[model samples]
Target: MGDRRLAIEAWESLFRAQHEVFGKLSGDFVGSDLSQAEYDVLLTVTRAPDMTARLRDVTANMLISQPSVSRLVDRMVGRGLVTKCSDPDDGRGALVTATEEGAHAFRVIGAAHGRSIAEHMACFDDEELRTLLTLTEKLRGYRSGE
Candidate 1:
């Protein structure tokens, strides 16, 4: 086994780095129509086929509780950012589809956010970035294949 002290130190470093980076990126939503949570929801929705995704899937990808995700979706519906409906294939499931306005907002903020992420991540070279990606994925219990 690896040194326990070294493992804890590494984990602390990773946590601090993530906290600092997220704090910086949180500014991307300032004065915007979408909050960080909304953007996160749309991020998954917009990438899904037909700009739609399962509510469960969205919730799975989020850091918040399932009930919180439901409430957020309700609020988004009220704002006309997205439409939520029961999934015909599964009575217990719901589907969310982005409205045109939501898609437009996502695109706008997504562009700027992308640039900001690139700028922040530019400190790492291509090789280092790849290594970081692999290490993070491994730490998350993600493997190349099931």
Candidate 2:
């Protein structure tokens, strides 16, 4: 078993670092055409095949609730950021596709956001980054031995 005090200290350090980095990175959205959450949505949608993805899939990547995501998508549809249509594969599901304008916006914001992320993470070298990635993935059950 792990040492409880050491585990708690590690968790606190990780949480605080994430919070600070995220706070700094959130500035990338200020005065931009897209908000941070919208960028997150596009981050998932833009990577999908043909820039289209199931609404459920997008929601899976988001930290919000399904209803909240649905509402956000509706808002994006109104802004010409994306289009929503019924999913052929799932009767109850919807599909979201990034518009030309939306894709362009995502690329613009994504570039700067990428830079900001790199700047914030610059304190860690490549090997340390790899370790951080491995540990975080493990925490999320992603790197668990299959």
Most lDDT-accurate candidate: 1
TM-score, per-candidate, Cα-based: 0.97, 0.97
Candidate 1 scores a C-alpha RMSD against the true structure in Å of 1.1
Indicate the residue-level lDDT of 1 in model 1: 86
lDDT by residue for model 1 (5-86), tens = 9999999999999999999999999999899999999999999999999999999999999999999999999999999999
Q: What would the per-residue lDDT of candidate 2 be over residues 65-115, giving only the tens digit for each residue? A: 999999999999999999999999999999999999999999999999999
Give the clashing pairs for model 1. none
Q: Rate the local accuracy (lDDT) of all candidates.
A: 0.96, 0.94
Give the CA lDDT, 0 to 100, for residue 92 in model 1: 100
Q: What lDDT score goes with residue 91 in model 2?
A: 98
lDDT score of model 2?
0.94
Error of 1 at 112 (Å): 0.4
Candidate 2 all-Cα RMSD: 1.0
Shift of residue 55 alpha carbon in model 1, Å: 0.5
Q: Model 2: clashing residue pairs?
A: none
